[model samples]
Every structure is written in C-alpha cells, then in structure tokens.
Target: MAKHDLDPNYLDPNYEPVVNRSGNHPFHEVLAARLQRRSVMKGTVGAALASLMGVTLVGCSSDDDDDAADSADSSGGSASAATELGFKAIPVSTANQVVVPEGYSAVPFLPWGTPITGAYPEFQADASNTGAEQEQQVGMHHDGLHFFPIDQKAGGNSSTEGLLVMNHEYINQDALHPNGATAAADNLGVRPEDEVRKEIAAHGVSVVHIKQDSNGTWDLVFGSPFNRRITGGTEMDIRGPLRGYCKLVTRFSPSATETRGTLNNCSMGPTPWGTYLAAEENWHGYFANSEVNPPREQTRHGVGSSSRYDWELAAGGADAYVRFDVTPGLGDPDTDYRNEANTYGYMVEIDPFTPEAKPQKRTALGRFGHEGVIFAPAVEGKPVVCYSGDDSRFEYIYKFVSSQPYSAATAGGYLLDEGTLYVARFNDDGTGEWLSLSLEDDDFAAKVTAANGSMVGDINFTGFADQADVLLNTRLAADIAGATPMDRPEWGAVDPNTGEVYFTLTNNSQRTEGQTDAANPIAENRTGHIIRWSEAGGDHAATSFDWDIFVFAGEQGTETVVDGEAVVTLDDDNIFNSPDGLWFDYNGRLWIQTDGSDAAPYQNNMMLAANPVTREIKRFFVGPVGCEVTGVVTTPDVKTMFVNIQHPEVDWPFGTEGDHPRDATVIVTRDDGGVVGA
Candidate 1:
C-alpha cells in the first residue's frame, strides 16, 4: 500500500472513472435520430419535440421579468402559462464571494466543523478538532439537502424553523488537518488512526435544527434533540432484498442485517413519508481488493486494487478501519471483511425528525453509485415510483416501482423494501421503455445467460440466481438488458406539476463520435446537458415513456433542426456547464446548479433558473472561485432558499481568500419578501 500504489484518480471526488463496459446504445445515436426527425417536421424543433413529449413550447425569452403569466398544461393549469423569473439576472463572477440577483440577500450559515451536539465545541480556524469532536460537528463538503418543516405533525408547514438535513459527500484532505494527514514515520502507507477516524467522521449526513429570526438571519439550534450526525462509523440497518443475504456477512454484522456507516454520500431525495434519502456515490473508491480476482460486485463497481484514503492501512489494525480492505482471508467469508463493501452503494433512508431511528439502506432500489433518488408524486392507491441515476460515465438510469400501493397513514421506508427495479432503454424514436431487472423478468435472465460466454472475470455472475444478486450487481444486469448508457448521470428532479422527470448528465469527456446518441449527442462532451422524460399517460408507474433533450450545456447538443432555425436558447445571461444539481421549486421553476471547471464566460460555478415551458434560463447566483454550487432547497413557503457551496479552494464564509477554505450553506431571500422565482 505504498503512496505511489494508491489510485490517484480515487482521491478526486469529481473523477467518475469510466466503468460501464455494457456496449449498450450510447445516447448520441438517439440524439442523431431525434435531430433527423426534427428536420422533417414543419414546426420549430422545440415545438415539434415538445408536442411529442406532451409539452407546449412558448416563445423563448432571456429577460428575467417576462410579464406573460398563465398556468402550465403539464401539471396544473392551461398549456400556455409558464412560471416567470422575477429577479434580474446577474453576471458570472470570479470573485471569492457570492453574487445574487439585485434585491436578494445571501447569508452564510452552518459551515463545516460547526458544533451541533455533544459538548458543543467551538470551531478552531486551524482545523485542530479531534475525531470525537468532528462526530458532534457538521460534516464537510455539503451536497444534497432538504428542509423539513418543524410543525408538520400539527399539519403546519412553518418556514421560520425546520430540520435541515444534508449529505457530506467527501472530505477536503488538504484542509481537514492543520498540516493535512500524517503518514506513518516508518511507512508512508499507513495513516494516523486519529486522522483516519476524523476523516471518517466527516463523511456522512447531518441533521440540524435551524431557526430564522425576525431579521432574516438563520442559526443552528445547538444541542437540539433533532440535531444528529450519522457518520461513516455510525451503525445502519440493512433493509430490503439483500438484508439477510450471505454475501453481506461480515465479522461486524454477521447476520447481514446491519453494517457501520454510509460513505461518499452525494445528493439526497425526500420520501413521500417524510424521510430523507441519502445517495451513496463513489463509495467503492474507499475500498481496495488485493485478491487475484475480485467478485463481480466489487469489480463491476470500480473497487480498485488500492483505496482512495488507505483507510485499511490505518495504524493499530482496528477492525473498524481495516474493514475497508475487501481482500479475502484464509477463513470463510463471514470471518473476514470481503462482504463489507457490499453493504454500501444503496439509497439510505433516514428519518430526520426521529432521532432514535436507525438509517435504513433500501436495497430494492438497486445499487450502483446512486446520485440521488427522486420519487414520483404518490397516488393514494397506486404503486410508489422513484427514479435514480448511476453517477458514472456510460452508466444507466433506473426506476423503482414498489410492489404495494401507497397509503398516507401507513406509508414508511418498508414501502421501498419490495419493488421492481427497471433500467431505462432509450429507443432511436421519441419513445422509451423501462426494462425490468427483477427476478420475474425472463428477458433479463435470457440476456444474462446469452452473454455468459463472453463475460469475463465475474466470479459471482451466476445468471441472475435471485433478486438479491441482481440488485447487488445492478450495473451488470442493466448492461445485459441492453439499457442506454448515459453521459455521467447525476442529480435528478421531478416536476410536481407536469410529472416530467429531469436528470443532469454531468459532462462525459470520454464519449467518442461513434458512441454519441440523442440523449448524449456530443463527442468529448466537456459541458454536459439535461434530459427529461414524461411517463406514459402521466402515470409514474407506466412502463412506457417519451423523452426529449431539455437543454444542452453550453449550447453544445443543439443541432440544426431546420434551415435557419436557431434552437440553441442559452445566451450570456444564463450559460452554464456541468449541470450537476437540479431541483424544481413548488412553483415549477427549475433550479440548475453547476460543478463545472469554470471555463471562460462561465467564470465560476453558479445556479440558474429555467422556465420549463419557454425554456428561458437566467443566471440567478454565482459562487466563489474554485467552489461547486450544489444542494439547493427552499422553505415550504419558497420565500427562503438554501444552497451549498462545497470544497471552496480558498478561505470562505470569513470573506478571506488565502487558505483553509470551509464548505458552508448560503441562505438566499428576496429583500421584499416575495417567492424565490416568482
């Protein structure tokens, strides 16, 4: 475990290594067909595609304050009404500060290392906090988050107070310590036990009770019962199909019903039953396999020979830290840590209001670098449905439909325990289908058996023996089923009004011209795009759907629909790349966040608002240099908005720009007290 032996790319949180070898139809080919079809259409490409997708297009306008106001046909009102952008658009900034539209205020709150429980230790600027202290403080690198109203049980949606829950994606190693992590004096391979513990403590979810004062300032309510930190060492329950599976047996959780901690948690989603869903993205990089050949579960998921942090090599050989190494021992699987890695890579459901509840890993959703899960609007007597995207190059998007119907009074995480997971297959035509990956799917079984001869190095590929196996090896199952390979699918949002599901395909630089398709049309796509699809008959449980390219990042995917027809709608007012985080406010205004490299014109990562009907985008806010603008949510009233600034390169929140940068949440509100995107 020498330093040089470490996987260099593993340390890069944004580096999604290309793991999908499915050879499935790439999205660019679909895009090519879509463009060709548009060429033959008489109307505008936007109008034609909108018609196919059951959407009505309006004249595109970049002005922030368009007076036309009507209800939208997708979910709520007439087809002509589109949500209007009320604020004046702002210019992109390279400054080490936040820039919002005029008449808006941005206040920083709940930064990393801010104590919320335990002894309530104060944050030291030198990063000298101990491992135990970090467990009681806010975690680092905030990502996906949500604000649950405080008085929901009383049937009240209070905007002044609530529980703010967020995911700490990963750590900024260089800034985590006074002088960074210390290696062993004798061997640079081993990390200090205390440092490793602190690092682990900083990688999970944080639930804090926050209150907004009359003056509009927000502060954390220290020592509240609802404030808790579920870190990498926290005990979590294993739920759903793989709960008692043999492959999950480890020295810690021998029953295979529980395991320790959640890692690499990225974006988050809310369950219909008032619970938070934390996505495990890039958790595979934290483990290493020394065996000559690893199981398909690890190999297919990109568990490399070397770990990202060398946690397995922590000093003193404590099982808590050493379990990161999945190398098989001389004893049976239960006697070693080979199955430890299998416990991760699933959507973990946590009840932020119930402090005593254990986080449940919902395995029925299928596991493969989940970016986040967005549930479709629940129907009283219909199946509960949700969608997730595997956040890696060439990976597939997935949909999970619960076997049981939904009921408000009895709904719980158990609803996620039994479901049929389907992988998306985008056809060259405008239509698409959800290919089932369940045990009852004969097509999946046949494909697995047919491809058995060509498959290599998968010791655990037993031809879809059971539902547990299919879920644990979800990427392989989707690959065999001929699912479409997307361009680094990341965060997703479900429009409450239209029932349209939107996903951000964060840039895929690995795509080639030969692999391009309609969903992913760009070759060497540096700036990614957003894709949206509407379920058939407006029913989320429907197997058939229609999809269209919502918008191309940096205007790259906008091909010529007809002669002299300009379909590229992005202008200087709202041009962004790497659209990573997406959310639709209750008003149906789509908020787009960027994690881009901040190329010219796009000075730094920012958040923009887009009108779904008009496809008009306007830059709303710009973040500091070297920071990713992610994890956005608003209070139930939509008057206040919270956005996370992760991994700032220089010192932030304190308004300095030299070093020891801290990730924090910024609160945005209109000075006149109006809706966020009114």
Candidate 2:
C-alpha cells in the first residue's frame, strides 16, 4: 500500500489508533526525532551552553541538607525561596488513603457524584445514577480548583468562607455504571443512550459554596445559590475572534457565536478578577471528525474516526450523540453538525459569583489542547499576561498579553478579546524567543509571507482572511512560525515574587537517542522535568527571555546529563518523576504534583514542596492507589490548602458505603493552626 493509503487519519478503516493518555512519553520521543531533523542545526550553539549549565546544576549533592547546597544555588535562584522546608519529608506509601507529614492533617471531602443543590440525588450502591441525576450532582474526577471567600470584595483574595470551583476531567466508567457498561449490541460496543448521557453530564466544571465551620473544619453549603455545575450539555458562548469565523458556522449556530458544553476540563486557573479558567485537555478524544477531507488542523489535534468513549455510538442517534460525528455530509456545512468540533478546544471563562452566567470560550488565547491558564502578577497600569501549555506530546507553550493596560476598575473579558498571542521556542543556550502568532505582527507576517509546507501550498500564510482564522487555526499558525515542540506541556504557574513562569513538561517516551533538547536533556524521558523562564528585562510584556531546567525528576540517586555535563542528582527525599501539576505559593515555594508510572518505591503519585533558591525539595503528601494528585490552592492567609485526589481505586473519601471508592477534594491544614507549608 502507498504511504498515504496507510494513513489511519485518512484511508485506513481498521486503524487501531492510540494517543498515549496513560502519562507515557514514547510518542514524544518519536516526534522529537522528526523535529530534530528539521531543527538540528539550530541547536549547535545550545550544546556548549548546556554543557556549562550542567556543571552549574548537575553536580550538586543530594544530601537533603539545609546549609551545604543552599548557599551554592541561592545566589542564582529565587531569594524568597532560599530557606529550606521546616518539616521532614514523608516516606513513600502504597496505601489506599491520603497520607501527610506528622505536623499536618489531611481530610478528604466533596467526592464526585455528591449533591449540593435542589436536584440532590444519591450515588447509589449499584452506581446506577441516571444522566439527569449526574447533571445536577458534583461531576467525576475532580481536578484543579480554587476557593473564593464569599465576603471578600471584588478583586480580593479570600481566606475565610467562599465558593470552591473545580474541574472534572473525565469519568471512571466501571465506577459510574452498574455491572459495568453494557453495550446494547454487547460485542458491537454500542452504549445505552442514558448511560452515555450520564457520562457527558459528569464531565465539566463545578462551583460549590464551602464554608469553615465553627470548629475551623470546611463543609459544603448544600443549597447555596453559587453551587452549580457547568457540564458537557450546558449552553456556552463562543466568544473572541472566532465568534463569527466562517469555519465555526454550524447547524446549531450558523452565526458561529454559540455552542454547547465544555468537556475534558482539567488543570484550572483562577483569574484575578474572581473568575475561573477551566482548560480543556485531550478534548479531541471526545470528538470524532468524520469529514471526508479531514483538515490537517483537525487530524493533528487528534480528531479522528473513533473516540475514547464512543459517545457517537449512543443508541438513540440523538443530536447530542450525532454531533460528535463531525463528518461533513454532502450538504452544506451550515446544514449539519460538521463544525461543532470547531467550537471547542478553548480556555473557558466562568464566573462563580454569577450562577446565571454561561461560560465563555476565550478564542484569542489560541486553541490546541489547553491544560490550563495561569496569570503573572498584575501591575497597575501594565497589561495582563497569561500563559498556557498545549498539553500533548510535541505540543507548544503559549502566552497571551492583553492589548490594553490593566485597569482594576475595568478589567474583564474584554481584555482577553484584544491581545497578542505568541508561542515559545526554547533555545539550547538557556535563552528563548516568543514567536508571534498574531497576523498583525510584522515579524510573524514576514516569516509566513512565502512559507510552504506539506500542509499548505506555495501561498502566503499571512494571507489568512482575518485574525479569527489565525486564532481558530492557532496550532497551524504556531507550526508555521517555527515554534519549538515540547513533551506534553501540562499545568503552569507564576512565582508571585520573581514573576518567573514555570511549566510542567510531563514524560515523553517518543524521544529517541540524540533527539533530546537541553530543556529535555534525557533520552526517553519517562521521568519529566520543570522548565522556568523570566521575561526579557524582567518585563512580562517582552518577547524574549532567559530560561533553565529548574530540576530533573527521577528515582533517588539517579543522575542525568545534558551535553555531557553532570546535572541533577536525585535523593531519597527529593526524588520524583513525571512532574505534572505545578503552582507557587505566596511564600515563593513551588508545589509539585505527579501522575507517574514509576516502579514500586515510587508507585503512588505524590506532591512535594520545593525551596528553589536553596535547592531543597521535600515530599509532602502521597496519594492512594490508582489515583491522580492534581489541582491545588490555598486561602489567602495560607492557613488551609485545598487539593483534588482524582479517580482513586478501592474507594476513598466517601468510605466503603458504595461498591467503589469515590474521588474527592481534600483540605490540608497544620495541626497547630499555623500557616500551611510554613
């Protein structure tokens, strides 16, 4: 068969496709090999610099001490984090319940399928909750979340009572169904319509009002007006540049200004204006693109013949199910649901305070596979800057700075609609450049004026009809601009004190020999690392910056080299791999979470706290079996921490009442009533 004929995305009907959703890295290695060929010469200068950096970072001792290496690295890293952690590290565990340090306490709360509204319904012992029941109950797989104090004024951070907003990434089918899933045509894999609907309703975001009891323990307010669920079937608005794009026109909204629901909501970001940014990751798997002439954009994003859940095969052939089949029919695009897929893959904005408001997809942020959106410290009179990672093997990191300067009196979604979007290209020399994706940028227009590739003909990419086209087809624009691809960029956070941006590049097994980049120094990086950068001249709006490999994740005592220079040496207390969720506390300490597949000693996923300046990393918490430790936040006082433990097996949080354990949101606080992580 011809090479093109064998392409699963195009010709193959029997294609058994897989996109590596199991926190693996093999796909990244393969993509690195291909990109290395295209950008090999580009790394020539980077090799030498990486060698020098290896000497500076790789040979450090893993003594887990306070004084020895602290002074050595403090001079170069963040001064605010120069002090070491005050507590001893927790030992690794294989238990089926949450574990924490001796001085701290962890309590599981708000498990999935719990009710907080008038539509209250119990998650039965048989796990037979209907689609309607799941619709109003808390969704499954609680991920990232935030606490908004009910009494805190606008633009203020709350430390007392408030609403807890969170993301529900996906569902656990076995735990959500009775007797497991039963396809009507058992062998054919056709799921019951009601079962499929229930799953859809369980995938999205949840906002519930939470308050601290008189005893200082947190409890959910069962019937607060703020308690709401924005699920995959809820109505939403298609805002920003793509609002009226021709490609977004569909039978549901030919005007391209509206759509339905948000799915695959993962790692979240809370806006300074009190709203929440729920990122859509791996959303392509929820959609099945059936167009005969599948656009390269759709295929590259992983929208194909089949989906992970096969929602399209729901028995009733309802519009909700049929819409997932994005195959263009013989009729016009507006006559069918062909463009419904285009309406998704965005950073959705939701207002927890306003329960009546529909979520809005901010298209100007540029869509691919958004893990989350985090903002830098906002300076009065300065424009707001936000960063996002396109969570996939060989995807790119993106930045968006509002066009207008900050106005606390006027800051809102308007700032997002008018901005410049740029993609990161990390150089080997510890420095990087931000390539513009905006059509209005002179440099970007010049680079694509005559660009030609396998996807586009010998036409000028700058000739796109409008800015909406650039934003809607953002992934393509980033590729055309020569942005560097990364190994599954996930969640990101900014250091409040130094304004340094940190992103988690999860494991990438696709990287073959000699395909390693300085930021990703190891071959077949099953264990990931953290990459951080400071904008040029320390200006958040700058287009260039300096960067470095903050730390390499692996088993204790493991050593990694970059360009032949010995870099990171892991130790018992600091050893961790597949660093996934990341956020810096107000104290300048970075909290690292993982979703790893490491061996027994490192079997359970964990969370650690690091003093970057002192080079101190201490494991703080370890999760239960078959669970993901993700999404974390704290009250303004930093007295209590909120975290999400997703999809734990053998049931947790809700006890052994049901057939399976329930995923939950946990509250961690100091036993002495002191600030957490102090």
Estimate the lDDT of model 2. 0.74
What would the TM-score be for candidate 2 when compared with the true structure?
Answer: 0.89
Error of 2 at 666 (Å): 1.3
Superposed by TM-score, candidate 1 places the C-alpha of residue 469 at a distance from the truth, in angstroms, of 0.7
Give per-residue lDDT, candidate 1, residue 557. 27
lDDT of 1 by residue, 472-524 (tens): 89999888888998878999999887889999988788867776444333457
- TM-score of each candidate structure, all chains considered together: 0.93, 0.89
Q: How many pairs of residues in model 2 come into backbone collision?
A: 16
Best by lDDT: 1
Which numbered prediction scores highest in TM-score against the true structure? 1
Question: After aligning candidate 1 to the native by TM-score, how far in Å is the CA of 122 from where it should be?
Answer: 0.9
